[model samples]
Target: MAIHKLDIGEFDEIDYSLIAIHTSLEDYRLAYFINQKLHVNLNKSKKEIQITVKEGEAHFSRFHYYEMKKDVSWDLIQNKNEVIQQQNENNQSLFSNVNIEVATKVYMLPEFKKVDYFLKIENSENDLNIVKLQNTLNTIDNIATIYLVDTNKIKSKNNLIF
Candidate 1:
């Protein structure tokens, strides 16, 4: 597995936050569902097949999809049933705070090879709360995994488990 670290200096003046979604499904399906469920219009990329929610986007690749699928399955098998149940309950509550009307954007980096889906929120005057956005995504049914990583906190971590 490869790990990538973020350079804090590059994002010092940026007031945006990133959310990553790891899944084994097609990006278009996921993007469309999210748009319908969240009531947002995610723009499509003409260069490559990608969907962006505002500036936040989702990409599809066979390699990453299979890798993430395997990892998610392994995680589920290793966890206890009760623990999973409790987490689901907590997620339900966590998603309650999400503001559906918040302006959100998605971007997918071509260098990542469609494996990583980055969600960018313009946090102008705290218009979009990172915590709430994270919670909302955590409850989504199809997403295999979701992460909220701050620019300052980026480091060599096992974010992508294949």
Candidate 2:
């Protein structure tokens, strides 16, 4: 991103997005980063980064990430759910006062009766508060029973297994 001073006789400011040149890292994956640094290697990339998209290719350190908001974080997450808790801390984005967590929580719900991928949220400015309550939840995906909870009040119950 960039900022510029407007020069139409009066002093003003303008902001711009600076696009980074998509480049190849051309390096080996640091095992330490994947392990200790919480970096996930989905697969072995032939190159560190790929500017061009391809089929069945793994671009190293590439994350299909999401940003979790404060309301949703409090609503959905339970205490000490390890994967979510860690992601909430490390990969949080800073736009609003939200805990932007990242994790791929794939579930097999018999009630919802399907498989689904759980990406926390897209961005901070987003407002997505509708979650399917398991007992009353109805979805074609059948595995989409994500609920909103009252953590402090200890209101907890769901049909599916975590």
Provide the TM-score for each candidate, comma-separated.
0.43, 0.18
Clashing pairs in 1: 55-105, 55-106, 56-105, 56-106, 56-107, 57-106, 57-107
lDDT of 2 at 29: 24
What range of 10 consecutive residues in model 2 has the weakest lDDT sum?
Answer: 14-23
Best by lDDT: 1
Clashing pairs in 2: 68-100, 112-142, 113-142
RMSD of each: 19.2, 21.9
**Candidate 1 residue spans exceeding 4 A from truth:** 1-12, 47-115, 153-162
For residues 1-162, could you state the per-residue lDDT of candidate 2 as single tens digits?
Answer: 899877675522211111111112221222222222322232332323222211222222222222232322211111111123222344445654556555433222112222122212212233432332222223212223334322222222221111
Candidate 1 structure quality by residue, lDDT tens digits, 16-122 = 45566676645566566555554455544443333433334443331111123222110110100011111122336747645443333232333233334555443
* Model 1 collision count: 7
Model 2, residue 121: distance off in Å is: 5.1
